[model samples]
Target: MRTIAIGDIHGGLKALVQVLNAIEVREDDTLIFVGDYVDGWSESAQVIQFLIELSQKTNCIFIKGNHDAWCERWLRTDTVDSTWYLHGGEETMASYKDVSLADKKAHLEFLENMPFYYLDDANRLFLHAGFTSMHGVEKEAFETTLYFDRTLWEVALTLDKRIKRASAFYPKRLKHYEEIYIGHTPTTNFDSDVPMNAANVWNIDTGAAFKGKLSGIDIHTKEVFQSDHLPNLYPNEKGRNKN
Candidate 1:
């Protein structure tokens, strides 16, 4: 049974399907989604429904992302005044505009219960954004794992770097058991595939919200699959130079 870790979907159900098709997932395999399931695209409802159904079919680990947290806040409070509404929340809401209140409540409940981080026996940690010093069920109750910023990213990055340096310095006696798999940050920021030692804490979020490609990574093998709509989807750091 292989483990496949997919990056942020951000409501791009079409792109997700394409990646799934490319992978040929099996019932015995596990699929870990890095979060940001909603917002950006016009298929938030579809994305949520897909997640619910997928969880039942396979060993699916759903980690909450910042956008997911925002959705939760909006749902639990009935107020759309959070940062989510400002980002891609507007698009997410539009997708479910016709959904019934009952259905919306059910979806929200599902999101509320999702884990902030998932740790496997193999020592791989799956988190949406990243994990802060205050993770686990205790602190996660207040802030979703998806929303952790510098606290999580920096420490994780530092630890990752240390591990790599150690491995390069001592290949035979490698340390560190956990491989951090994170999303929220996009690969577009860097030139090469982000690899923190064997712990490929990849940021496959090619920025679908900005029309970037949707990406998925296969753990163990370290192979990556991406949507074809990469170039046309999002504008790069440099604003569009349209004619």
Candidate 2:
């Protein structure tokens, strides 16, 4: 079966629908969404609804993202953490004005139960962010597997002094298991439209929430489909604003 991976949808439901229609995914094929499914746009609730339906429509896997994690916390407690809101949770919360508590709870459970990482028989690992290899560290603990790998990052920050210690840190070590597909960190490096590296590790989060574009990669063919949203689509420029 053909496998396709879609990047962060954020809350751009229009872009999401366009990309899906463009792909023309078949029911027999498998589609894996690499998280950040909500936030950024005004249709967070609609996005969640679409995903729920899509899950039943075919063989699909919804991996959790850092944004997805905070969304759950916000829905459950009704208070958002600064770190979470800073990364698009605000837009998500603002989008859910009509959804019922029952629906929200169901969505929250779906978000919370999301797998941090997925490893195929061929060793292809699908994670929302990064991975950490340590004893007793559940795939969920890496957080980076669905958020960011702070521990590995903290070590990277100490490079000057760390280099003196004679030890090397290679986040690439996770590559040994199988290729990893990640999101969260946008491939675009601020203002640039170019996507980040996806060779050794497939990073599908093409910054759809930003001025860049939304992308989906066909795993088998390694082909990428993207949708751009630069010029305003709405006449008054209401929700047509870029993320």
Candidate 3:
């Protein structure tokens, strides 16, 4: 019954499939996806449809992401945010051109129902981005921060290795969970194409939205599984690489 924390997928359905196959997921394994399921690659709509079906046979927990929120809003209201459009939403919109209205409504409901964060029985916290509350996620004043904040990751990255959890210098937010698993900030941004751990926070987002691979990690054993780089899988697509 291993629990795996999957990183931001960003609509790379092929990469998602590759990682899941690499994991050789068993019937009892729990898959917790730390969001950004759409926007970026060419299969945004297909990816949503796949997940919707996959959840029926597997135990899965989905966390909401900023991009997902934007896509959900567009699906519900037909209003596109310019910022979202610039950041992979254009590709997401294109992916839905052939999808039926019924499927779109179902997908919109899926996105709308996802929680901003999830806490496992082991006290492990999983979220798409980060939270700003020192008292933990429940105390977060702004729901948006859970899927939009980067300060949590930034603080974790800058913490001194010498600082013990019991020490006064350790960040209060880090102490709230047995461990924190997050996506949104790609490990590739720091030059690593694999999952990176800073303090007690594990960032599994390997930048599938750009030039990196999609990644997943076993929470207990810390075993990483990755897909071929998105560029390799999607050849002609630029993904979210503006250049």
Candidate 4:
């Protein structure tokens, strides 16, 4: 059984569909999602809907993203966060404008139940974002760093790959995990549009919400699959609005 980790979708339903269709998933295979399943594009509702159906097929682990938290707050309490609205929340709202009340409620329940991280038997940790070392702290801090941290990726991107290989911060930040997977920060921000690696930390968020493609990688093999640029597939919508 293959364990595949998928990056942030950011409401790119077309890209999501294409990537899922290309992959070969089995009943025993495990699927891990790093989060940010909603917002950015105008297909947030559809993206959630597809996930609902996909859940019925195999083992699916959904990690909560900051944007997912924002979406649930609005769905359950009717309180609109102005910050969310400024950062692709408007586009997400537009997608659900026509969804049925019952369906929306179901989607809310799904989002509300999402976890912040996943630790498997292989000692690999998956989170929406990895933690930053403060005074040199381990990367995983319950769910706090799992959803909000960017230091894990930041430090990895800044240092030379050789430094990571020789002296791993995995023990400091990732605890006992052999490897870690994360999303949240787009790969485009690093001026690349592919999955990146630093020591035992792997970043698969290829920025499908921006000018990059949706990415999926086999956790064990590092085999990659990608879709077209999000804007190319979604011509009418601006993938993300700068806040």
Best by TM-score: 3
Model 1 clash number: 3
Off by over 4 Å in 4: 132-144, 160-171, 241-243
Q: Which parts of model 2 have CA positions greater than 4 angstroms off?
A: 134-146, 150-172, 190-199, 230-243
lDDT of 1 by residue, 1-243 (tens): 889888888777877888888988898988888788887766878889887887887888888888888888887887796566767777777878888888888889889888877878987777776543333423444554445553444454445445553465422211233466777776544543333322344555666555466777788888877775633443342111122
lDDT of 3: 0.95
Q: Residue 64, candidate 1: how far off, in angstroms? A: 0.7
Q: How well is each residue in 1-243 modelled by candidate 4, as lDDT tens digits? A: 899899999999999888877676778988899999998988999999999999998799999998999999999988889998888889988898999999999999999899888888977988898766542333434556667788778766666645544365433554446888999988888888999887678999999988899999998888998899998998887788344
Worst lDDT 10-window in candidate 3: 234-243
| Model 2 error, position 237 (Å) | 6.5
Clashes in model 1: which pairs? 210-234, 211-233, 211-234
Sorted on lDDT, highest at the top, how do the candidates line up?
A: 3, 4, 2, 1
Q: For each candidate, what TM-score against the reference?
A: 0.79, 0.80, 0.99, 0.91
- What are the per-model C-alpha RMSD values against the true structure? 5.0, 5.1, 0.6, 2.6
| Pairs of colliding residues, candidate 2 | 130-144
Candidates 1 and 4 compared: the better one by lDDT is 4
**Best prediction by lDDT:** 3
What TM-score, to 2 decimals, does candidate 4 have?
A: 0.91
Deviation (Å) of 141 in candidate 1: 10
In model 2, how large is the Cα lDDT of residue 181?
72
Error of 2 at 22 (Å): 1.0
User: Which runs of model 1 end up more than 4 angstroms from their true locations?
Assistant: 134-146, 150-177, 191-200, 230-243
Write model 3 residue lDDT over 1-243, tens digit each, in one string: 899999999989999999999999999999999999999999999999999999999999999999999999999999999999999999999999999999999999999999999999989999989988899999999999999999999999999999999999999989999999999999999999999999999999999999999999999999999999999999999999986
Q: What is the lDDT of residue 100 in candidate 3?
A: 98
